[model samples]
Target: MISAHLPALQVVIPLLAAPACVVVRQSTLTWLLALLVSWISFAIALTLLVQTFFNGPMSYELGGWAAPLGIEYAVDVVNAFVLVIVSGVSSVVLISAKESIERETHIKRTHLVYTGWLLCLTGLLGITITGDVFNVFVFLEIASLSSYLLVSLGPDRRALTAAFQYLVMGTIGATFILIGVGLLYMMTGTLNMADLAQRIPGVAQTTTVRAGFAFLVLGISLKAAVFPLHYWLPNAYTFAPSAVTAFMAGSATKVSIYLLLRFFFDIFSETFSLRTMRLDLILLILGVIAIFSMSLVAIYQSNVKRMLAYSSVAQVGYMVIGISLATTTGLTAGIVHLFNHALMKCALFLALGCIVFRLNSVDLKDLAGVGRRMPWTMAAFVIGGLSLIGVPATVGFISKWYLVLAALERDWWWLAFMVVASSLLAVIYIWRVVETAYFKTGPVANTEEAPLILLVPTWVLIVANIYFGVSAVDTISFATRAADQLLSTF
Candidate 1:
C-alpha cells in the first residue's frame, strides 16, 4: 500500500514539508528539512522512472477512484525524466541555500523564505506528476504564486518590480490556460489527460478544440518565455536572490517546455498539431529568431546574471527548434537539452552565487581579477562557459549535436548552420565574463573565496556537466525512451 503511493509521495513529501519549515521557524532546521525533502523527492523520481522502464506506465488513482472521475497521477518516461531533473537540481541547489539565503534574503523573513521554497518545490513536482489537465493548471498556479514571492524576497528593491512583472505575465498566462482548459472540458466532457486524448480526435476539427489549442499554446509560450514574449525573464533572474535564480534557472521554464511537449504530442493528436495547425512552422520561425536574437542580447549585457538569463531564453529557442521538427530525433534533442541545459545553467548560476557571496555584485567590471582570488569558483564558471559554447566532450556539445543532426535529418541545412552559429554567440558572452575575471585586476587588494558549502554544490553540477558530456549513453538512452513515448502517443 505504501509502495503504491509513490506518485502521491513525490509531491506530498515536499508539500507537507512547507508547513514543517514554517512551524520550525529556525533557519537551520528549515534548511535541513528542505534539503531532506528535496532529496526524498529525487529518490521518488528515480523510483518512478525505474518503474516506468520496467513496468510501462504506472497510474495512481486519487481516493482509489479511477480516471475520468477521480484524479490520477501518471508516470511515463517523459515526465519521469523531468521529475528526476527537477527534484535533483532542487536538492543540489538547496545544499547551498543556507549561505545564499543568509547573504541575499532578509533576516526577519527567513522562515517565510523556506516555506515559500518548499511550496514552490511542491507545485513544480505536482505539475509534473498530475495526469489531469485541470490539475496541471492548478499546480502551475501553485508554482507561479510561490515563485513570485520567492523572487520578491530578494534584498534588492528591483526584486519587487521583477516579481510584479512576472506576476502580471504569469497571471495572464494562467488565465489563458484556464480558459483553454474550460473550453476543452466543454467539448470533451473529461479532464483526465489520457481520457481527453482518447476523446479529442472525435472533435479535432471543431472550432472549440482549435481555439483551445491556440490559447494553450500562446499561454504556455508566454510562461516558457519563448522569444518576443521573454521580457520578464532577465529582470526576474537578475534581481532574485542567487539561490532562487539558480533553482528557477535550472528548472522553471524547462517545466513549461515539458508542458508544451505534453500538450503537443500527447493530449493533441500529432495530425492536428503538426499537419492542420502547422505549429511546426510557427515554432521553427520563433526558434530561429530566439536563438540569434537572445544570444546577441546576451553578448551585450553588463550584468553577468542578466547575460545568463538571456542565454536561457536562447537555450529555450534550441528546445523549440527541436519541437518544431516533430520527429523522434528532434524531440529527443529537445528532451535531452531540457536536462543538459539545466546542468549548465545551474552550474553557471551557482558559480555566480559564489561570486556574489564574496564580491556582492555580478557586474562585469566587479568580476575583474576574481579568478585569482576565487580560483575554484572562477574555474567552475569557465568550465560551465565552455559547455555553453558547445565544446566537444561537454553536455552542450552533445545537445547541440543532436539538434544539428535533427535539423539535417529534415534537410534544413541553414538550421544546422544556425545551431552551430548560436554557440559562437555563447562563446563571446562567456569570454566576457572570463576575461573580466582573469585579465583585469580588482581595485581591492585582498578578497576571500566562497565558502565550502557553496563551492561543493557548484562543483557537483560542474562535474556532472563533464561527466554527462563524456558519458552520455545513459542520458541519451533516457531521452530516446522519453522521445519514443511522446511520439508513440500520436
Candidate 2:
C-alpha cells in the first residue's frame, strides 16, 4: 500500500539519508548507506516512470493536502525520466566513488564527503520532482552548495579557487532564479508550477512575465554552463576529486537543462516561448556557435579533463539545438541526447578517473604508453571516445541521427552539415588520445591498469551506452512521449 506513492519515496529516501550519512561516523558505512539510498531511489524512480507511463501521470500532494495549498510531487514521464537519469547516474557513479574518495579525501573528512554527496543527490532529485517554482530554487541551491564543497575536495590548492569561483557563480544563478520566482509570486500570488502555467498567460503581455522568463533563462543557462557562460566549468571539472568530477559531469548541468525545459515549455506557454519571443532563434544560434567554438578550443587544450570539460559545453550545444527546434521530433532528440550524453560523459570521465588513479595527472603527453599497462581502462576510454566522435553504431550516433532528423524537419540542412563537421572535430581531439595511448611510447611504460572497482563502473556505463544505441526502443518511446507532453502544453 505504501508502494503507491513511489514518486514521493523516490526523493524522500535520498533527502533523509544525507544527514544520516554524516551521523554514521564510519566512511564505509556512510558509503554503503548512501549507495543503498541511491539504489532505492533509482528503483523508485524507475517504478514512477513506469506507473506514469501506464497510468497517464501521477501527482502526490504532501501530507494529503491539495495542490496550491501544499507541496506537490509530480511524476509525469518527463520528470520521471529526469528522476531516472539523476538517480541512475548517481548510483553508477557511487559504485566508482569508494576508492576514489578514499584516495582523495582526508580521513577525518570522509563522512562529510558522504553527507555532501547525499545532499547533492537529494537536490538533484528534488529539482526534478518539485512542482513549485520556488522549491526548485531551494533545491537548486542545495545541490549547488553541495557541489561547491565537492569541487573543493581535490588534492590541489587550486580546488579552493575553483570552488570559490563556482560558489560565486552558483550563488548568482540561484539569486536570479529566486528573484524570478519572487516576481512570479508577487504577480500571480501562487508558486505551484501548474498554477503558474495557467496564471502566467494572462500576464504574458506584462513586463513582469517577460522579466521573469529572461531571468529564469539566463540563470539556468549559467547553471547549465552554456557557452559564453561556462567559464566556471573547465576549472571545476579539472580540480574536483575524481568521484566528484564523475558525479557532477554526469548529473548536475543536465539537471539544470531539465529545469530550463520545464520553464520554457511547461511553465511559460509556447506562444510566449516561440512566437512572442526570439528564444528559438537565440538558442539555435548560440548552440551552433558553441558547438564550433568549443570543438576548436578542445583541440588546443593540454589538460585532458579541461579538454573534456570544453567538449561538454559543445555537447550541450547539441541538446540546445534540439530544444530550439521546438518541434516534437527535435524535443525527442534533445531529451534522448540528454540521457545518452550522461552515460557517455560518465564513461569518459571514469576513464579519466582511471588515468588519475594511475598517473595522478591528465596531461595528454603524460599518458603516452600507459595504455599497454592499462589496456582495459584505455579500451573503455577509446570506446567512450568513439561514442563521442559519433562513430556509426555507437550511442552518440543514435543521438546525432535523431538530431539530424530534427534539423531536417525544419529544413535546416546546414545544421546537419554543422553536426557532421563538429563530429569531425571530435574525431580529431579523441584520436589524439587514441594515437597517444596505442601508438606512442611513453615515460610510464610499466604502470598498472586501474583497479577492478573503477573499471567495473566505467564499463557498466560504457556497455550501457552501446546497448542503448543498439536497442533504443525503450528510450525512444519514453523520449517521444515526453516530447508529446511538453508540446501538448500548447
Candidate 3:
C-alpha cells in the first residue's frame, strides 16, 4: 500500500524535509536529514524507473482527483531515467556536502544551506514527475530560487553578484515559461500535459500556439544554459559553494533538457516540432555554434570550475545536436549523453571540491603540483577529464560514439566531424588542468589528500564513468527505449 504512494512520497519527503531542516537549525542534524531524504528519494526513483521499464507508463492522481481536472504525476521511461539521475546525484553529492559546505559557507548558515539543497532537489524531482505544465513552471521556480540562495552563500563577495544575475535571468525565463503555459491553457483549456497533448494538434496551426511553442523553447533554452543565454553559468559555478556546484551541474540542466524532450516529443508532435516549426534546424545551428564556441571559451578560463562550467555549455550543445536530428538514434544519443555528462561533470566538480577543500581555491595557479600533492583527488579529476574528452573506455566515449553513429545514420558526415573536433577542444581545456597539476611544479599549501568522505563520493562517480562506459549495453538499451517512446508520438 505504501508503494502505491511512491509517486507522492518521492517529492513530498524532500519538500517536507526542507522546512524541517530550518526548524532543526542544527548543521549536523540538518545534513543527516537531507542525506536520508536524498537516499530515500533515490530509492524511490530507482524503483519507479524499474517499474516503468517493465510496466510501461505509470500515472498517479493527487487527492483521488482524476483526468484533466487535477494534478497528475506521470512516469515513463524518459522522465523515470531523469528522476534517477537527479536523485542519485543528490545522494552522492550530499554524502560529501557536510565537509564542503562548512568550509565554504558560514557555520551558522549551514541549516539554510541544507534547506536550500533539499528544496532544489524537491523542485527538480517535481518538475520531472509532474504531468501538469503549470506544475513544471512552479517547480522550476522552486529550483531556481533555491539555487540562487545556495549560490549567494558562497564565500566570495562576487557570489552575491552571481546570485543576483542568476535570479534576474531565471526570473525572466520563468516569465517566458508562464506566458507560454498560459497560451497553451487558453488554446487547450487544460494544464495536464497528457490532456494537452491530445488537444494540441487541433490548434497546432494557430499563431497563438506557434508563439507559445517559441516562448516555451526559449525559456527552457535559457534554463539549460544554451550558449547565447549562458552568461550566468560560468560565474555561478565559479563562485558557488562546491557541493552546490556539483549537484546543480549534474541535475539542473539535465532536467531542463528533459523538459525540452517532453514538450517536443510528447506534448507537441515530432512532425510539428521538427517539420512545421523547423525546430530541428534551429537547434542544429545553435548546437553546432555552442559546441565550437563554448569549448574554445573554456580553454581560456583561468578558473578550473569556470572552465568546466563552459564545458557544461558545450556538452549541452551535444545533447541539443542529438535532439535536433529528430531520429530515434539521434534522440537516443542525446538522452544517453544527458546521463553520461551528468556522471562526468559531477565527478569532475567533486574532485575540484576536494582541491577546494584543501587549498581554498580552484584557480589554475593554486592547483600547481596538486596532482602529486593530492594524488587521489587529481586522479579522480584526470579520469573525469578523460571522460569529458570522450576517450575510449570512459562514459564520455559511449555518449559520443552514439552521437556519431546517429550523425552517420543521417549521412551527416560534417556533423560527425564537428563532434570529434569539439571533443578535441575539450582535451585542450582538460589538459590545461592536467598539465598544471601534474607537470608544473611549485610550492603548494597542502600535500595531503582530501578526507575519505569527499574522496569516496568523488571516486564513486569516477568509477561509474568507467563502469557504465565499459558495460554500456544496459544504458544504451534504456536510452533507446526512452527514445523510441518519445518518437512514438511521431
Candidate 4:
C-alpha cells in the first residue's frame, strides 16, 4: 500500500520537511532533516524508475478523482529518469552542503537556507511528477521563488542583485507559461497533459494554438537558459553559495530541458512540433549558435564559476541539438546527455566548492599552484573537465558520441563537424583552469586538502562520472526506451 503511494510521497516528503526546517530553527537539526528528506526522495525516485521500467507507465490521481477533473502524477521512463537525477544530485549536494553553507552564509540563517533547499527540491520533484499543465506552472513558481532565496543567501552583496535579476526574468518566463497554458485550456477545455495531447491535434492549425506553442517554447527556453536568453545564469551561479551553485547547476536547467522534451514529443506530438511547425530547424539554429558562442565567451572568463556557468549554456546546446534532430537516436542522445551533464557538472561544481572551501575563492589567479596543494580536489576537477571536453572514458564523451552519431545519421556532416569543433572550445576553457592549477606558481597558503565532509561527496560524483561512462548500457537502454515512448505518441 505504501509502495502504491510512492508517487505522492516523492514530492510530499520534501514539501512537508521544508516548513519543518523553518520550525526547527536550528542549523544542525534542519540540515539533518533536509539530508534525510533528500535521500528518501532519491530512494523513492529509484523505486519509481524501476517500477516504470518493468511495468510501463504509472499514473496516480489525487483524492481518487480520475482523468481531466483532478490532478494526476504520471511516471514514465522519461521523467522517472529525471527524478533520479534531481533527487540523486540533491542528495549528494546536501551531503557536502553543511560545511560550505556555514562558510559562505550567515550561520544564523542556515535553517532558512535549508528550508529553501527543501522547498526548491519539492518544487522540482512536483514539476516532474505532475500531469496537469496548470500544476506545472504552480510548481514552477515554487521552484523559482525558492531558487531566488537560495541564490540570495550568499555572503556577497551582489548575491542580492543576482537574485533580483533572476527574479525579474523568472517571473516573466512564468507569466508566459501561464498565458500559454490558458490558451491551451481555452481551446481544449482541459488542463491535463494527456487530455490536451489528444485534443491539440484537432485544433493544431488554429492561430490560438500556434500562439500557445510559441509562448510555451519561449517561456521554457528562458527557464532552460538557452543562449541569448541566458543572461541571468552566470551571475546567479557565481554569486550563489558554493553548495547552492553545485545543486542548481546540476538539477535546475536539466529539468527545464526535460519539460521541453515533454512538450515537444509527449504533448505536442513530434509530427506537429518538428515537421509542421519546423521546430527542429529553429532549435538546430539556436542550439548551434549556443554551442559556439557560449563556449567562446567562456574562454575569457576569469572566475572559474562564471566560466563553468557559460560552459553550462554551451552544454545545453548539445541537448537542444539532440532534440532538434527529432529521431529516436537523436532523442536518445538528448535524454542521455541530460543525465550525463548533470553528473559531470555537479562534480565539477562540487570540486569547485572544495577549492572555495580551502582558498575562499574560485578565481583562476587564486588557484595558482592549487594542484600541488589540493591534489585530490584539483584531480577531481580535471576528471570532470575531461568529461566536459568529451575525452574518452568519461560521461561527456559518451554524450557527444551519441550527438555526433545522430547528426551523421541525418547525413548532416557539417553539423557533426560543429559538434567536434565546439568540444575543442571546451578543451580551451577547461585547460585554462588546468594550466593555472598545475603549472603556475604562486604564494603558498593552506596546503591542506579539503576536509573529508566535502571531498567524499565530491568524489562520489567523480566516481559516478567514470562508472557510468564506462558502463553506460543501462543508461542508454532507459534513454532509448524513453525516446521510443515519446516518439510513439506521433
Q: Give the TM-score of each candidate.
A: 0.99, 0.98, 0.99, 0.99
Cα RMSD (angstroms) for every candidate in the order listed: 0.9, 1.0, 0.9, 0.9
Residues forming the 10-long window of minimal summed lDDT in candidate 4: 441-450
- Report every candidate's CA lDDT: 0.92, 0.89, 0.94, 0.93
For residues 94-164, could you state the per-residue lDDT of candidate 4 as single tens digits?
A: 99899999987875777888899999999999989889999999999999999999999876899999999
Residue ranges of candidate 1 with Cα displaced over 4 Å: none
Count: clashes, candidate 2? 0
Highest lDDT: which candidate? 3
What's model 3's TM-score? 0.99
Candidate 2 lDDT over 365-391, as tens digits, reads 998987797999999999999899888
Q: What digit string (tens of lDDT, one per residue) describes model 3 on residues 294-355?
A: 99999999999999999999999999999999899999999999999999999999999999
lDDT of 3 at 267: 97
- Per-candidate clashes come to 0, 0, 0, 0
lDDT of the structure predicted as candidate 2: 0.89
List residue ranges in candidate 2 displaced over 4 A.
none
